[model samples]
Structure formats: C-alpha cells, structure tokens
Target: MRVLIVEDHEELAHTVAAGLRREGMAVDVALDGHTGLERASVNDYDVVVLDRDLPGLHGDEVCGRLAAGDRPARVLMLTAAGTIDDRVSGLGIGADDYLPKPFAFAELVARIRALARRTRPALPPVLVHGGLRLDPSTRVATRDGHRLMLSPKEFAVLELLLSARGAVVSAEQLLERGWDEFADPFTQTVKVTVSRLRRKLGDPPLIETVPQAGYRI
Candidate 1:
C-alpha cells in the first residue's frame, strides 16, 4: 500500500517511514502540513497518516481540504491529545480513523492496512488467478501449490499485479505504488524487477508486456 505520513517531528516521521518501508509498503513523508497536503494532492495514496497539530497550514485545514475533494485518501489522524473530543473532532473533519500519540507501532500498522483495504474493491483474502495464489496477509505466494521464493521488491510487484486483477498497470504506476520516493523514474528498475518476477512465476507467462504501454497480468 502507498502511504503519506504528515508529521512535523523529523526524527519520528523518518523513523515511521523506514519501518513502513521494511514492511514492504511504499511511503512518503512530509515534515510539515503544506508539503503533506501538496504531496497528497498529487499522489494517489491509500492512507494519509496526518498529524493533527501541524505548522504552516494546520492539520485541520489540510484534512478538511482533502475530505472535500473527490477520491481523497483515507485519513488516519494522529494527535498528542488522546481525549474523546479530539478523536471525535478528527473524525468529524473526515479522518477515517484516529490514532493518539505514543501509540503502538503494531496497532498503527494494522490500522493502516485496514484503511488501505477500504480504499479499493474488496478482494478475496487470497488473490487467485489461474494457477497462482497469493495470500497477502501471510506474505505467501504459491503457483500450483508450490511456494515461490521472492525478494521484497519482487513480492511487492507480484502482489500489485495480482491486485490489478488482469488490468494493465503502467510502469509509472508500479514505481509509485511499489517503490519509495527516491526511486529513479528514469532507471530500468521496474523493467528489471518485472523480468525477475516473471521468471519466478514461470510457466504460462502470466504477466504480459504491452509493447510501450507497460504491463498487465
């Protein structure tokens, strides 16, 4: 899933971003509300981890703006205040969920995943197409019941393609959703990863390249 974390605490923001990345999630960080708003506006994010207290725009305003827009991201509001009023206000402003500060990392991950799931059409717990089956929650991929060993990148790529449900996914879309912000768009990383992933899936060549139009399952 792709997430945007809007927090002013530099260390905390980067730390959270790193953890999410290690969990095979695409993450982008904004140290202030304006940058966060700008980033969220341009990108298609499954969830926005927004800090309620922010500089240069206030988190409330940012949340309101996003909530009013069409196809806005699922907002998970974060605040130091743990009061019921605070959470209610956050939710009132269109945050889909609320997380108080000093929260457990595991809970945060779980909530993010839960929110991400709501952003798209509900799919079966195990994504199945032809002979391939991917259990996202367990991080397992099996082809004809044979477990496939895949790198994090390869796994992310495959998961995305399977989630696409045979729809074509552009290289740009793959890079944005599967890779971090630092990925060089001009580089051949997407192509390279797709090639490697295809070899592992083997057999019927399920991933089809559409000439200059990117790829589809």
Candidate 2:
C-alpha cells in the first residue's frame, strides 16, 4: 500500500519510512504539516501517518482539510499524549485511527494495512483468477501451480491487475497504486514493470493491452 507520513521528527520519520519500505509498502515522508498537506494533495495515498505537533501547519487543521476533501486518504493521527481525551480529539478531526507515541512498530504496520483495506472494496485473502493465484499475506504468487519470481513492483502490478477482475486498469492508475511518490510520472517505469510482469507470467499472453486504453485480464 502507499502511505504518507507527516512528522516533525526527521529521524523518527525516516526510520519509519525505511521500515515500511522493507515491509513492501510505498512510503513518503513530510517533515512538517505544510509539506504533508501539499504531498497528500498531489497523490492518492491509502493511509496518512500524521504527527499531532507540526511546524508549518497544525495537525488538526491538516486532518480537517483532508477529511473535508473530495477523496480523503485514511488518516492515522500520532501524538505523544495517550489520554482518552487526546484520542477523542484526534478522532473529532476525522482521523480513522489514533496511535500514541512510543507505539509498537508491529501495531503501526497492522493498523496501516487495516486502514488501506478499507479504501478498496473487500477482497479475499487469496486473489485467484484461472491459473493465477496470489496469497497477499504470504506474498506468494503461483501460475498453474508453478511459482513465479516477481519483483516487488511486478508483484504489485500483477496483484492490481488481478484485483481489477478483468476490468481495464490504466497506466496512470497502476503508477499511482503500485509506486511511491518518488516515482517520476514521465518515466517509463510502469511500462517496464508491466513488460517484465508479462514475461514472468508467460505463455498464451494472459495480459491484454488495449491501445490508448489500458490492460486487462
């Protein structure tokens, strides 16, 4: 999933970003609230890890604006304050979840995944279509009972295509959902990834590309 972290603590933010990346998540960091708001506005994020104490803009204001927007990313507010009142206040501003500072890394990851699940329609744990089967929790993919060694991007692209249930998935949509903010929009990265994915999936050409449209299975 793609996530945005808005934190004033640079070290903590980078640490979290690295850990999340290692966990197969696309992450972006914003040092303060203003940058966070700007980044959040530009991208389609599944979750936002926002710090309550910010420099440029208050966290509450940031949360409020996002919550009121047309398509708001799920907000997970973070605060050092662990009081009931504190969480209540954060939720008052429309945060989907609240995490007090000094939280467990595992819990944070779990919460983020849970929130991301809410963004998309309910999907089965194992996504299967014909000979293709993918177990997301295990990060495993198989075609006709044979294993496929897919890179992170390739795996993400295939999972997205499979999840579309044969509906056309545009190149732009794949770029947004499969890559992080650092990905250059003008780059041919998406095309390259899809090409690699098609090779990996192999014979009979399962993926169909429609000219000027997109890809479908």
Candidate 3:
C-alpha cells in the first residue's frame, strides 16, 4: 500500500516512514499540512497518516479538503491529544481513524493497513489462489504447503498482483504502488522483481505477462 504521512516532527515522520517501508508500503513524508495536501493531490495514496495539529493550513483543513476531494484515500489522523473528544473531533473532521501520539508502532502499522483495506472492496485477510497462500500480516507465502522465500520487493509485487484478483496490472501501476516517489520511472525494476517472484513461485507458472500490457496471476 502507498501512504503519505503529514507530520511536522521530522524525526518521528521519517522513523514512521522507515517502519512502514519495512512493512512493504510505499511511503512519502510531508513536514507540514500544505505540503501534505500538495503531495496528496499529486499521488494516488491508499491512506494518509495526517497529524491533527499542523503548522500552516492546519490538519483539520487538510482532512476536510481531502474528504471533499475526488481521491479515495482513507485518512488516519494523529494527535498528541488522547481524549475521547479529540478522537471524536478528528473523525468528525473526516478522519477514518485516529491514533494519539506516543502510540505503539505496531498499532500504527495495523491501523494503517486496516484503513487501506477499507479503501476498496474488502479482500480476505489472508490471500489465496488455488494451492497458493499468502499471509500479508505475517509476510509469509506458501505454495502447495511448501514455503517460498521472497524479497521485500518481490513480495510487494506478488501482493499487488494477487490483490488485483487476475486483473491486468500495468508496469507503471506496479511501480507506483510497490515503490515510492524516488523510484526511477525508466528503470526495469518492475520486470526484474516480477521475474524473481515468478522464479520463487515455482512450478505451474502463475504470473502471466500480457504483451505490451503488464502482469497478472
């Protein structure tokens, strides 16, 4: 999943971004609300980790604007205020969920994933096709009861393909979702990752390449 974190605390923002990246999510950081809104406008994110108190424009306005916008990205508001009123206000302003500051990193990750899942029609918590199974939460994949070792990138690519449920996923879409903004658009990273994933999937070749289109499973 792709996420945009709008938090003024540079250290915390980057730390959260790194953790989310390790979880196989493409993440972008914005130090203030204006930049956050701009980034959100430019990218198709699955979720936005918005800080409730921002420097300019304020997080409330950002959340309200995003709620009014056409983009479907879910919003998970964050704040140092932990009162029930604070959470209710955050949700009233359009947040899908709220997390107070000094929260557990694991809870933040889980909340982000949960919000991302709600962005579209819900899928099974554990993805499966035939004898192949992938537990995203555990970062484990198995085929016919045999485990498959996969790199982070390879796992991300496979997840996207499987999430599509057999729809053709273009290379550009894969790169946009699997990689962050810094990725080189002209590179063959997607091709290489897909190739490695196919090799690891083994036997009965699951991923299919559509000429000039992209890949599917």
Worst 10-residue lDDT window for candidate 2 reads 116-125
lDDT of 3 by residue, 1-217 (tens): 8899999999999999999999988999999999999989988899999999999789999999999999989999999999999999999989999999889999999888778777467877888999999887888999999989998888889888899999999999999888888999999999999999989898899999999999999
Q: Stretches of candidate 1 above 4 Å error?
A: none
Cα lDDT, model 2, residue 190: 85
- Number of the top candidate by TM-score? 3
Compose the digit string of candidate 1's lDDT tens values, residues 1-217: 7889999999999999998887778899999999998998888888899999998899999999999987548999999999999999999999999999999998899888778767457656678898899876667899999999998889889988888888889999999888867889898999999999999999889899998788989
In model 3, which range of ten residues has the least summed lDDT? 115-124
Off by over 4 Å in 2: none
Q: Give the TM-score of candidate 2.
A: 0.90
Tens-digit per-residue lDDT, 1-217, candidate 2: 6789999999999999998887777899999999999999989888999999897799999999999996648999999999999999999999999999999998998888778767457667688988999876667999999999988888888888887889999999888988887788899998999999999999978999989989988
